[model samples]
Target chain A: MADEEKEQQKQGEMEELPVILQLRPVPAITPVEEQFLKKFRFLKAWESSMPTELFLTTYAQSVRVLLCHGGTPVTADTIRCLPSLQCVIATSAGLNHIDLTECRKRDIAIANAGDCYSENGADYAIGLLLDVLRQFSASDRYVRQGLWPVKGAYPLGSKLGGKQVGIVGLGHIGSEVAKRLVAFGCSISYNSRKKKPSVAFPFYSDVRDLAANSDALILCCGLTKETYHIINRDVLLALGEKGVIINIGRGAIIDEKELIQCLMQGEIGGAGLDVFENEPDVPKELLAMDNVVLSPHKAVLTPEAIVSLQDLLMANLEAFFSNKPLVSEVKDE
Target chain B: MADEEKEQQKQGEMEELPVILQLRPVPAITPVEEQFLKKFRFLKAWESSMPTELFLTTYAQSVRVLLCHGGTPVTADTIRCLPSLQCVIATSAGLNHIDLTECRKRDIAIANAGDCYSENGADYAIGLLLDVLRQFSASDRYVRQGLWPVKGAYPLGSKLGGKQVGIVGLGHIGSEVAKRLVAFGCSISYNSRKKKPSVAFPFYSDVRDLAANSDALILCCGLTKETYHIINRDVLLALGEKGVIINIGRGAIIDEKELIQCLMQGEIGGAGLDVFENEPDVPKELLAMDNVVLSPHKAVLTPEAIVSLQDLLMANLEAFFSNKPLVSEVKDE
Candidate 1:
């Protein structure tokens, strides 16, 4: 969990074990690499005494699969060094860190964390939403500060039931969030690029329309050109004075400056943000507000999700070795 | 809302309207007395210049309905003054406030909150459990204190999915908690006085055994002679160092002293306590711990739940006057 920069190697003595090449450690937060060591040997470029370029060239002809982490970018230049890399296994759902163009051009197959973190992501979104509506974090703070006795009853929080909650995306994670919110009796509508044929939740083609109707807008969409600063001033105003926003998606998906202003001006009621525009460095203004609950981009950092991710990564690697179709192949766009 | 000690009147002009007698304003936390004003007239004793006993004596023959709040006790002495008091309508689920013995002796019907707060209770229970398991309060605190960038990553939290959760007293609130947790993929088991005949959830007659098998124990049972201090040191030990305790039930259902020691000694994983044995005066020790989420017993204080309670109270009063069986009348044991 320390985010160690130095890439490491494990399991050297096994003679017939399958090998997976790594530019760096996959997912630096969890020390789950120890689990991976038992089944597959890692040929890490960062562990080499030689330069990384030289290390990659050494394995260029033989390396069939490459393991990529979110922190480490899989650049076209690096991909050019490996002539026979068949597939790229990613530790993140977002392909921003991995060069999809390079992979697509090379005809290299890919497997991201496909539904491996859907449950965790969904759970966190609802958790943040609940925290906002019920003022759980605020109540916890009042008690922790020994102010409960001094400050009488904390202000009453609104209920999740009978509230109209709109989801920003309705993909695997968004759908899971919708399902959980349904259990709380929240009516869920959603905004995706297009209306999902299988999803019954009412869909909005525009973000502004979704914000206008929703009591809270939970951001579950990925950050992209179309989605950058999607939650801007207009959306925040539409969400209104008593509305809340819970972001489990990328931080930049929201217009952070406008969000901060809305929170400060009480244009919006409250926010439960797991991701920030610049993670680790939250807005100074938000720290003082009891209405807002901030987290350091830890939506997918649950133990069960980690285990599932490890399984998915292992399965993808094994699938490549066995010449079987990948279990969650990233479809070619 | 302030806990107003002075009882006040809302309406006086309505003629031929049915009167519901109030010893005090029902449920002091919400100032929603205005809604009650439109329906019925109140014969409030506190508003009279005469002594309270004299006020009751004047209306003894005509005052057929009595209203009670949680803070205002309707003792046997008071009930004796109202010979025609045919029913007692309480603002709380617990009947300890009104003289249940006196009500039963006179065959006076009683209606408590019943299932009015059930949905809110369940929502808060799951919310607290999710807070404990996922460390939302801790993560929020870290970000609020400007520790995210300095701290890098918050510690990984355990997932709710695939974990065994045990409910203590699978009643109305407990059932709702089970329904929500199941949507999150949590396996639920319960321990009640007897296994619920209609419920398919695995049952344990003993609390200790339920704690031993559960990753978390959610206390949703009512506090009775059989259940007071049901969760003691032995139960906490059975729950073990990795198990969480979520108290949505009465505070005394758990032995506060033993729970504190468990949390302090790391005998239990954590706790999400909404009710403390001594509320408004939570133990100082629990205030400093990051693992515990302490709330001021606001589980059923949601806006929607309040409206539901208002409707239920009105329905019960109307039912009593219409010669119908009370919707949520407390059964004589």
Candidate 2:
């Protein structure tokens, strides 16, 4: 009778453990994630030798939480497959890849990395701006190529102080970018969906108007239906020659083809870009341009930022299982 | 009799006009110098086909002011050549190019570019720091080299937030660097000759102590006898493996030879150097290292800064001729 009672209790304890579903492994983004996976167990769909469809159908019947990130698209099809899935946890600040419409329609709770990537994103955006205005990498190449004496005097770069900088989105990343730029004596104005009452910076309802007033334009908004190709030829023309554009937001937010054309025609001064429309495939024309600084979509990647992302993911998962609200939940618009 | 009197008055007016002796053409530094030369005439020694010594001996004998910059050194011999030289007007901020001891011994009033270049110098210093820590230039190289897709994922950079930065000199440039870093959420400390009562940041009189506690060291101090080679092998050792060094001051402040050796041995992480121990001659080893960023000692050269320098130089000359206190005069140490 004692043995039978012990067996029944063991089975009940196994049922109590919450299962988290992952389409792919988390270690793809950060190396520190593997050890943390042991602490917070995730049922990785990719790990199974069985077909992903078969595994999802068999194992995710009672799964309530799905863990994903900006790289992995959690589509309507995937969400519909998991009948019991009520929550989605993303490990990135940007939610463009998460199929927001599907999440909203199903009433599934969503949590993102929140402000974990804000500081790093802001640091990088400003870094790119400085690199472009200062011609840092171009000059570094000149020095490394032993052209100093031959060149006589390096070209004087445009000054950063007292420049009018326009920030797009003015969300976590944009706001943080503003903080750093103010210290450099830059005046900031921003554009967003709606004017924020708490913000003191001048607001421009139209992106083109912001470009007209700015010496530089820094993109920090998310990719959305309205925001896609938000920065087109009209905006570039408004920014004008000697107007620098730094993009840390998604690439499609700008019209890539038009931006290249503007740069080729010398309509815009320069650009500092982290994200591209089709990443890993940068325009060949920009590769030789000294004014343009290109980075491989690494603005939000940092060692400390990864740690913060992990903490945020753990916090969201714990809260959901405990029958509490997510820490940084994205509400339906 | 009337023509003779008119000639006498014209001679008196020509004598009243101040003569400025230049060892070389100021136009070599800035193109604006050529236009300003006609307004405030400078006797260019290089313009004469005659030997510089012969030109100085003949024309500079009665010249009361000398115009020089960092590139054209006003050595003890050069100062000795001009017996009537009462003032030295430097277009550059740092007066290390001019022999300070010789000037002081001869009782010659010296006026440097004052705070004209401070904003730009600070902008460059912080820009170098951000570039070094955030790997802005290195990543740009990767993207430009078409290695993004081939590399899969670029390496992560260190975060700027909460980093402990040590300023070697708390002059105008260092103060600006601190202000910018604070906005990025970094803690700052400094090592100067004496701690200012007004500054809230922790100060270390001994630079070695500062190196032990800091993640980065920025050299913004003037190149003095005591400050020369301030950052040596011992100091680099204390800064440890991950420490970064940015020099916007004179190149001699850090032992470039030892810095290269440390960087090679992985004893220190990286360096962002604008001024090298020798001009136009950076260590060959640093040219290949990804962590090292080299510039051609043009940190203080900016479009707006050149304008400011001309204004400062003009004001100092006017004040000196009027028997008023020389503006931005460097006090004798």
Candidate 3:
């Protein structure tokens, strides 16, 4: 017993010190997410919203790295508070929230899980399309209201087959959405910044022209300064009465006031939205209309997406720690 | 001007024909639906609903055959009134609304478009499955209620992949539903009066056992005296908490009161209903729950289904007129 106690004490003395760092709340991470986190032996994981002071005090110790997930923006104050922080890993495609210039000045190696959410976003885009075309959501409401034996000309729903679908962005998610739409017997076309030779679909140089021709327009491109409020009143009006616009991209990509105006004026038939500009606070005007289907910014919260993101984040972390090329790096451009 | 006056007189004669059976309102009809009617020398075409007397008087004269569609039941009085009616072609699967006994006694041939609606029903079954499993409808409601940043631990929705789906019937629509469910990675099992040699899926001898084991139970069986209210309270109770029930068949096949009881007591998780016992007027109790998804008795009302049904009906009518064997004749078993 005495020898065992002495051995335990020696083992404790040789144990490595813990690395303390703040980890923000991520979407439901699966077993795969945990497996990736297991590699960081010296790090402490916080799965909830923690105060800045607590994070700073922890960073003052052995912590040299911090991780954020779910496209959370890392403010200048967050970085300034953690003096010892040298690395920031964000498990999301977009890094708009992170102050990259400050990170570069602080010599912090930054990486994000880019394009990992493409499949999830595309899946959601298809779901929204089906919901709108099939009138599933509206029918559900009607049924719940004891309005079965649907009034007027019953079963007036249209088939998704043989319709022209216009994709606003032919990026990772957009391309995937296009592929799925094709499977449903839809003709696909798109509008992108630059035309690509790889895609088989016809490309329109202008968004208005694309909208004017398409039965439905899907927004799946990344949000940028130039692309902000890109789908405005003129573009919506151009799409005309038979068009439906589905925004799975950033909400800022659409002009809310203009969209509301067009929807009210019957310029567009319907819309399916996921993300918003100032999220957790959608426009009351949009809610009042029955022609739109809205969702919380949870298009990328599927179990598959969570696991993929975790795997990508771990891959990035391993490369960073070993002084190898990071998996997903952001360029200044 | 004399030629034009002659043509107008001929057109007026054609318009005054006695037989005018209005089919369901559609933007257009397939060439097949119009084939039999084109052969009828005295019949005229109308786009509106027929008055009771006009319908009966037409059947008494040039309208030896009457074609019906949609859910309005043909009463015994209506059948008795049509003394000269030689045949009734119902372009629908269910015959509960049609007085088959009266037609049989009068030696009138009765045919219906049955199997053609199977694919349509299957499509709707999958739509409901996707709607419930993906929480598509629930999420829409949440967004509409101005509930942003959906609070608490959101319920984890299960993927259809690798789950067991039990079909209550192995008939045309049930089999079709099974085919689509299999594509979504579901393991299929079914309960039928007799085992089907064509299908490779396991057949359960008992309905209760099938209900107990299935993740989701889909009803696609026909309504008959022997099978009425087969999925009663006990069968539903056996399904337990995780089970989701979908009814694309006749609502009489399920005990509505018992189903509602189970839903209210939380014995079953959810249900997707397309028909009801006393339809066009759903039970007030069922309308109170958010767990259930509802659609009017219009599952097979798709354009594809409509076109197919009309074609089948026309073919049957042509065969009857030509003294050939009917394609889908109603048999007294």
Candidate 4:
């Protein structure tokens, strides 16, 4: 009788593995994603010879979950095509690629990459800040160019210890940055939209005020209408000639044009930028500056973070299938 | 009556101000050094018209304290020339700059910059490690050279979290590095001459064994006869193709030629080097590699550290003048 019961349970498990619809191929599906594929069957729209609409009409009719990333835009029209789509899972932190209003109207649930990226993102932000302050990259260039022998001792870099570091947003990533820097003897303060009652770090409601008091400002806030161009000329001037600015957030969070001008004219000390206003189109003038450090928007791309993202994505899918609370759901604001 | 008392106190203070002989001009003298100058009169050797030997013999008869930096070596002969010399105050960490054998033979006291550079040196070691592991400098070069647009996204970096880091010489700077990396979730292990009884991190008796177990090796041990070329080919190969090396300690601790070959052949993953075997003359072949981060031997040149060094130097001088125990005196082994 026990054998028969086990047989029934095995059959039930074998028959009930959930299906996840793929709107397009992910740029690179790592081993973690491959592991997810072994558990769930995918209805890949791009692989179908039929048009996207026809493919959605036929195959996606029975699919309840959609797996998407930054490269693919799950527009309202695309959402309208999938009648049975109840959940959209994003593999990236930012949701600008998704049409949120349409999903809200449709009463569909959304889950993002969540806290998987917070640690690595924070680490990268600190790395960029250190590179700028210590002239790590700039000195590397000097050494590589055979200038170290010709130029003698490189200029001294500012110390990170005891510097007033103002975090632009004390969100998950910002908080992680604060934790890591505190170990280096840096004092932490922050400016966010609202004061977090649970946090111990000093908070300021105005970013300009925070800039005035800070030796360095690390931008980690989300990109929104209110935050767009938030770090403008006034904030730069307030930070003064000895101040540094580090941005791991969106490009437009700072006024790139003004920042370029300030950096060129010595109006500000330096900058460490992961994201750019134009991206791939950094100002040519910045190429020669010894104080600036630039990266191509890759603060969150780490193998460990990607693996954690895969786990979170799988957990959200599993929870949705079992009628459980979404593990990392993005609720409508 | 108060005015007369104040005048007497001022005269006593003027009589007590220490006289120090300056062997050479420092690279740059900040306000802190100037403040020191106000407290003590410096006999500038370069400003004197007589030959250095003549100047020392003529003006050094009454001099008891000598001030020198790492660049100006205080040879045994030079120490012997100043018969009245009682103390040598070094503005650098390493004692290789001064003739310790002569100082010990004559029972002359010596003071070094102690604990002043530990914080900045540790900060720089972490920064260089971060740059190498995360490709901070490489990605910066990519963005600066306008290659980001042409190249889609830079390759993913390995996460710092959960990595096994082995620190060589668990001294002041090594301990500080351990403290900082712990917050990043990295596991710490160490290899020194002897196991530290108080330290909780795992200790390895042999460096090769440490390299075999660790994903990264941070060199912080002083360069001595026993430690010279300690990180040789065996250790590099033991660290293997995926391992990284970070050196904030002196050069010649690792075999530079072998390190270059390993880095070129992918025998070891990468390196973050502040001090090279031949400093100001880094291997030109390393110029093209994205895996290495090079600095111009400036792990401890911060303004804050310089100020602390000034304070420590002044305290050492004052302690010597007052017949008090030298604050950071280097005792002969």
TM-score of each: 0.90, 0.95, 0.76, 0.91
Better of 2 and 4 by lDDT: 2
Mark the 10 consecutive residues where model 2 chain B has the least summed lDDT.
Answer: B28-37
Q: Residue A94's C-alpha lDDT in candidate 1? A: 65
Q: Which model scores highest in lDDT? A: 2
Docking class of 4: medium
- For residues B1-333, what per-residue lDDT tens digits would candidate 3 score against the true structure? 699999999777655633434333323233443554455433323432676666566546556676665465666786676677777777767676677777778887777776777766776777777666666677778877766565622354545556799999887778877876655558999998888898899999888899988988998877767569999988898888878899988899999999988998899988888788887778888776667777777676777666767667667866877789789887751
State each model's CA lDDT, in order: 0.85, 0.88, 0.73, 0.87
The residue pairs found clashing in candidate 2 are none
Docking class of 2: high
Write candidate 4's Cα lDDT for B1-333 as tens digits. 699999999778855777788889755344666777668877888888888889888876778999888678899888888998999988877666687888888888888777888889998999988898889999888887778889778888888888999999887789999999999999999999899999999999999999999999999877766789999999999999999999988889999999999999999999999988877788888888899998899998888888788778878878888899999887732
Say which prediction, candidate 3 or candidate 4, comes out ahead on DockQ: 4
Ranking by lDDT: 2, 4, 1, 3
Candidate 1 lDDT tens digits, B72-104: 889999999989889988887766556677778
List, residue by residue over A1-333, the lDDT tens digit for candidate 2: 599898998666645567888898665335665554544556789889989878888976778998886788888888878888899988877788887888888889999778999999999999899899988999998988889978777888989999999999998899999999999999999999999999999999999999999999999998989899999999999999999999999999999999999999999999999999998899898899999999989898898988888778878878998899999897732
Once model 2 is optimally superposed onto the true structure by TM-score, how far is the C-alpha of residue A47 displaced, in angstroms?
Answer: 2.0
The TM-score each candidate achieves on chain A is: 0.89, 0.93, 0.80, 0.88
**On TM-score, who's better, 2 or 4?**
2
Ranked candidates, highest DockQ first: 2, 4, 1, 3
lDDT of 4 at B160: 87
Please identify which of the two predictions, 1 or 2, would achieve the higher TM-score against the true structure: 2
Residues A1-333, model 4: lDDT tens digits: 599999999767744667788889864354656677557777789998999988888876678999897658889988998888899988877776788888898899998778998998899989988888889999888888888888798888889989999999887799999999999999999998899999999999999999999999999887767789999999999999999999998899999999999998898999999988877688888888888998888897888887788778778888998999899897832
